[model samples]
Target: MKRFLVAPLVVALAAVTLAVLPGSPAAAALIDARVGALTFRPDAPGTGARRLASASVRQDLYLDRVSGTFVLDAEPVAGTTSYLRVTFGHLDAGRSCQGDLELRTDTTSPSNGFTRSGRTLRLVATERRFGYQDWDCAFAVLDLDTNGDASDGSVRSVLIGELTDVPARPVLAVTGVQLLDARALRLVRGVWTTIEVTVANRGRADAARVVLRGSGRGVQVRPTPVGVVRDDDDTTVQVRVRLTGKRATTLRLTASGGGATASRSVRVARAKAPARPRPGTYRSADGDTTFSVSGGKIRGFRVRTTTRCGGYPDIPTTTYNTYSFRTVGVPRNGIVVAKEKGRLYTARLQLRIAGGKVTQGRFSYAGPAACFAVERFTASRRR
Candidate 1:
């Protein structure tokens, strides 16, 4: 919020680029608009009529799920403004005059008009007739056909229409993902996260009708389905990717939409290493070892793994606790259980072979409990 109480030393209306708007069909495409925030024009200084010193314009578009409407957001780039005429949509009722986009704007001025420049200047409407800038001319464009144009006229700020020729998309980018196990990528069981897919208009021409698809074998969509809320939106879908079957080894995801295609992979398994060996539990980042026999002594050992990486910058990184074993062999057979505050966290089994290096795992937790796996696994082997 830019406050201009004590007249700004100078009053200047930062430049404004009134170009095309969002939710528009295929066309030459309008260059985004620029908001000149906190403009101070000394000559036309702050007053009851013109008091905007400078300001910025931020334009964003989104597809509304409830209203099935396209929403555009215009924010000041630098500072506050006295008035802003956002061009989002215009309709020519009965073709009486140049169609004017009915937009909702929070402005500083009560009197103003929407204008445009072309072969012949046209006046959409004066602010006097329509006190509120927002107009709902739903029936106006009912018969208007936008073969290659999505607007009623050359855009000054906003425009909207239907797409006649579906566009050709070139690239599908995986900007972000949620509910995926960090290391294996298999869907983390019982969790929901957001996944983002950014589809760039790659071809020489613009494309429309963009969609994103994700699926896998037995890899059920995790009871969480994903879809496109809007093309340029940062948050796309909330997905719950889960790998429930221990027998199933893999989960595959594919995204297709906007004339482009992409794929991602996730491997599922017991979320951690083995969990027993009471005083002899230990684990490594990666690699599955059969057994560790030190000096012909079969030291019973179980390895485990976990994660807690998602945290604020101020949060401390999770630390790995190690558990030392007595001898190089498997401890007594027992259900390797890990508990936190009386809550059953994970369970694993310890199995060692005679005259051979064989180790069987019991359990491994994947979240905060994962950090203490080794220390707990080693504690189970206390004689």
Candidate 2:
């Protein structure tokens, strides 16, 4: 790490004579004094090329009735040396002095040239070293002493400062996208669907904000605004789209931030008309078995027996057993068939009905049981 040593002349240059001459005028007495220091480091390991750490220091000094302030600012310069600027405020008695400086590397002292314009002093060094490392740098500010004897003047006070820069470029990428609504699979014309797009920052810098844009032929798409995304972090935004064409369409979405952009696409097809089933409660001729059909599918069923079929055991002879079935295909000609397949058993059922009533049906089951059978029965629709 960079180190700074800021000490008053009275404490640092005690060997220098400050005594009054017996036959001459009295020497100026030491009064109030202050010292400060600063250090800067890279924000990240690989970011040193584009960014730097920042630091500053301030001090107040008083001599008798006079008071003054000193401020230091420091920062790293891209592809160049570190820069330091010092400002002097409310100098005592309005006194002005030129600043000379040296850059210290261990025991070796190298002169780092400086210039003073008005009350500000500036220094630049080719070695951009700071923080703890094998080698460190220190800056020393020097000036002529109050004593008329030039040979007696020596090091008096010191101060420190630092600066850092942030990465200049940002890289954005779209990592993944997903459709939020189940309707995305059956996208009908003139209907809207929700989609989620995830964005990530793959660069070394953070993005303060990201903007999303979406477009597609034969569809209107809108995207939600995404806020900040840090380096190596990701965020998701919502995109809503409505299909307006009769054919399949592709929707493209783009995420842009900090001069970087990424895009993703999704394909949607026009929906087909759903099969319509005769909707009503259906029952078998024995009245001990029943089925409910809705929206062109066998939605529910009940059976009375001692044997288990398709992982479902038959109900007691006094009661009916009920369970649900999944539709696997479109209904045809007022006939709806459904099936339930499991590791232990598989079942198939075909129901023929019309005018909101069941006319006839067949239910079959196959499993490890040797007595597996198919039963054909006639049904009557409930009034």
Give the top-scoring candidate (lDDT). Answer: 2
Worst lDDT window (10 residues) for model 2? 129-138
Local accuracy of candidate 1 as per-residue lDDT tens digits, 65-91: 001121122322223332332232222
Return the top candidate by TM-score: 2
RMSD for all candidates, in order, please: 19.0, 20.9
lDDT of 2 by residue, 203-303 (tens): 65677668888788888877667777787789966566667888888878788767678787777777653335556787766776676666655655765
Assess every candidate by TM-score: 0.23, 0.30
Off by over 4 Å in 1: 1-170, 175-183, 186-213, 222-236, 272-383
Global local distance difference test of model 1: 0.31
TM-score for candidate 2, residues paired by index: 0.30
CA lDDT, every prediction? Answer: 0.31, 0.46
